[model samples]
Target: MSELHDEVLRLSGVGKTYNPGTPLAQNVLQDIDLRLARGELCALIGPSGSGKSTLLNLIGLLDSPSAGELYLQGRPTRALDDAARTRLRNRAIGFVFQFHHLIPAFSVLDNVLMPLMIRHGKPDAEDRARALELLAAVGLADFAAKKANQISGGQQQRVAIARALVTRPALLLADEPTGNLDTRTAESVFALFRRFNREFGCAVLVVTHDPRLAAQCARTVELVDGRIVRDAANTAAK
Candidate 1:
């Protein structure tokens, strides 16, 4: 695949094990081969201890695989140094976790621009404009000047979503992003993801335990005991 429309993430014979080479070594994932293409919205569903979180970390470049290879945007990443890995992650991947992780003291706009500030020390006009645009897209344009602690739970999560998209990453990874919201709020958050995936043309891989939420994704990848038991299209999910 080429740059604009290439595989966002590719795992070949990927495996992860904790305490490797020790008597207490435990393999968590094995031979996990998968490819997520550009603009695809996929759900990763699995039970507790199924290696779902572990796999997400590896894919997000927060962790490395014990075996095989993980490629992001056609580039192999296992051998990259800490600095290189961090750079790559910031440039290519966006993450939204269960908790918003917003800085309570910072205004919503500043929070959304945090990544850019980290990279450039301060954001330029274009950067600020993009952040505002994302906040608008998430339905939080008016809340930009307010502190994160001042917003509702759902609103805070929407700010997190805007923050994640500020970098215009090629891939977006979300782990239980809507887990803390009410059913209606959860659905709205999920809808924002879908809308951003389409508008930004970014591939999305979201981990979710809620079957109802998972059913909304275009594809489902079920993991059990660290293995991909099923990877199939869910046409009706849309």
Candidate 2:
């Protein structure tokens, strides 16, 4: 609760179950309560089947919870309609996945502008400037004109980070964003998340398996069998 004054995302008793009937039902998450405040950088860590991604999806508003409620910026989101949810999601949440899903045909700058274009009809000068600025912030200013496929894997991931932050979202959710990168590159990528969280005051909840990576975060939340087993401050490993 470093920035307790303003909570960006809150989950209360949230749970999710897939195919709730016909003998194929499975509870992926259980009663869970978590909160992310502005400017907080938290790591979510657990084993492979611990439901970390499912929890992230619930917080991102990409998937609905089967029980409890999620509040985004203090507004109840569980009851919001599809249109309302989409609007809120676009305005409030940014997502980064393990794979940098940049379009091979689009330039780095254009790919960053894609989010804005989706929300509006076309990109104007201001939007383009913002996208470029984000690229620069991610240390990719010179690569703005390069096609995504032409960049290195680490550079491509940086471009992905820039794309996620182009909209200046209040909450950023990354699911194993560094899982596919080398150890050194993964550390650097994780540092970028820290920089954004501190510089932009955007709350970041990143799912990672590396203990070294998790140790860099201010806070860590561990999930086990869809339940939050530990949520606490990160201290030097003994």
Candidate 3:
């Protein structure tokens, strides 16, 4: 396959500006050019207010870019309508946020099955099997029947990861996934991302402020003042 065909994501001169036509308009991202191939593990690092969150939001299809095109799984997203964007995002991208966001009332297994249930009302036997498999992979099989709120924060985050992967998305976008965890817990959560990337061949892009966690990614992209200042491979990735 051609290089383009191998890429799971591509941003061509992508830019984002809030309140675009007003004097109060603030440009959050500019001339952002990037690409991630299948199974590539990359870390996005930048100082606060450097636009990392905005960039991830755009890439995750939560918002549209104002000045350029973004292609996800080779499909151009600039002109896609809201419904189309939603559909594509659900099918091609998975997300893990700083907060696990699992419903407190739901069982751990139910949380993992949420995505599938959203895509197709009421998960079937196969869906349950997949959820159980993911829970086991994350070492949470024993907690499957417990309420999400009953688990520890780190365990909840693992449940979130399992939920994100249930769809088998082509790209996984994780925004500060381990920001609230302790050092040891953080490392374990980060490892789950690497494991899933290798096993599932999904392109992984994680935004993290932790240098230790960032160093583990194979590639790193640094953003500053709304533009990428550096994007390079880590020679000593763990």
Candidate 4:
């Protein structure tokens, strides 16, 4: 089967530790087994210090697990070298954080095209067209020429989401993406995630503190003290 149709991510007994092999070592996650399928939209919810961030880091390939294995598209990542990991991350993942890290001086269009430019210098015509399409999808079609700072906070965040999708990554990770927006704006932003997930078949795993947001996802995974306490599905039905 093609990778596009396979599980986007899998964690088996994944665990994290700080100051390993020492008395001060702290275990944040342990025996975490989870899988996210293609086109699935799930919410990751946990309290402060529950290791949500740590778990995300491991999934995103930004950090390594202290134990267990993390697989992306069926590729084991524990032994991958830095260059290999970076390449995989660039090719397979898109990230949106709570803060819209748009470049203030760059035009919104340029900001949205930033990822492709980083991977391959200069944007081709097709790349520009793709960015425009995303901007329009995010309701920022006309703001492309303006600087990122000139737009409303919600608008800027929309641009960030567009930027994240420009690469058409197989998996999209959002960490508290709506935490800074007003309720209305937050809903709009989340709606974009749902829209893109349906349109592109990219799996979405978002970490949010808002119960309202968590409940909206098809599946909700609750983490407590670095372990998955509950992994519930069919949320919309319940």
Candidate 5:
């Protein structure tokens, strides 16, 4: 297949400035040109003040860029209306945050089904089955009936991963998904990302501060002072 056919995301001259016309204006990201192909797993690394999260937000369509355009699955995003953006985001993108953000009131199974529920009112039998299967994949099959608040922090994060994957999005954007866990737990959580990236063929862009974790990805993109300074394939990736 051609590059266009395999392209899941592209950003062309993209920039984000918080308050463009005032003294308080701050440029969070600049000239971010990037492309993620189908099933590719890449890591975004940067210092504390860098624009890593800002870039992820733009790619995830949670925020609009201040300049240039973004394309998701070859469709331009700058011209999309609010409803259209929501529809496209739901259909093509999945997000996993450091906080997991599971609903404490819902059961684990219901939590995984939230994305499907939000997209189409109530979920059907197939949706429920898919959620269960994902839970099983994450080793949470036995905890499906438990409330979200009842699970350990690591388990809650697993639920978040399953929830993100329930919609089978073409691209998965993770913003510091392992930032809160212990070393062992973090590796386990990240392993799930790799596993799903391989099995489901979803393009993954994960923001991480850990060099060890970044080294595990096939490609690494480094950011500094709101600009990408390095984007190269890892020769020793495992």
Candidate 6:
């Protein structure tokens, strides 16, 4: 494992409260402090209602923290405006959700190129080449011409991983990315995450419930009742 000093994502005393100032107000996370270093593969695991997703959202820059500060690439993000946050997120973060969220109408290649297209108008040959390279990396080069919906669940998730990598993000966040797959398939997908983290030197934070899956990561952070309970090295079981 790398030193914590080389952190990519850092959360200090972070907290989140929803619907503040109303009867529905509820605190979802409390005093969360964590750090993810480049090339690190960490697992965020907790039971239902443990605020794992909330914490992930906060770190991914998709939601703001109610307290404390979050640093991405060593820059404090508490004061960044929406446009600044969006630009920072686009340049530094990649996300994969439980659902692949690929457009069924678009071809797999186009789906992988979505991020690049959003940043710049049309995809040039270089962009297309990178998209194809990612597809090949995910073992889906042949599926590039097919519509997203034509692929299997596992294949679609692979495409999502490729799409996430298209941006060459420094931090990759995945929430239950393998939740819908069979055990074997899930292992395969998880392996791909490990491969990419090593090859691209990106920090990965994945939320999962399976102990076996969590065990595969280099570090694991456990949350319960909106608070961090444990953070430790995996120490792979013999």
lDDT of 2 by residue, 110-171 (tens): 99998898888699999999998988888899999999999999998998898889889999
Query: C-alpha displacement of 217 in model 6, angstroms?
Result: 0.2
By the lDDT metric, which is better: model 1 or model 4? 1
Candidate 2's C-alpha runs over 4 A off are 2-5, 236-238
Most lDDT-accurate candidate: 3
Quote the lDDT for 29 in model 4: 95
Candidate 1 local lDDT, 112-157, one digit each (tens):
9999997788899999999999999889999999999999999999
lDDT, residue 228, candidate 3: 100
Show the colliding residue pairs in model 5: none
> Per-residue lDDT for 48 in model 6?
98
- State each model's CA lDDT, in order: 0.94, 0.90, 0.96, 0.92, 0.94, 0.93
Strongest candidate by TM-score = 3
**Evaluation by lDDT, superior candidate among 3 and 6:** 3
Instruction: Give the per-residue lDDT of model 3 (tens digit) for 96-197.
Output: 999999999999999999989889899999999999999999999999999999989999999999999999999999999999999999999999999999
Worst 10 residues of 6 by lDDT: 1-10
TM-scores, each model vs. reference = 0.97, 0.96, 0.98, 0.96, 0.98, 0.96
Provide the global lDDT of candidate 5 against the true structure: 0.94
The better-scoring model by lDDT among 4 and 5 is: 5
Number of residue pairs clashing in candidate 1, backbone atoms closer than 3 angstroms, sequence gap of 3 or more or interchain: 0
Alpha-carbon deviation at 224 in model 4, angstroms: 0.4
Runs of candidate 6 exceeding 4 Å displacement: 1-5
Report the Cα lDDT for residue 58, model 1: 98
Distance from true location, Cα of 79 in model 2, Å: 1.6
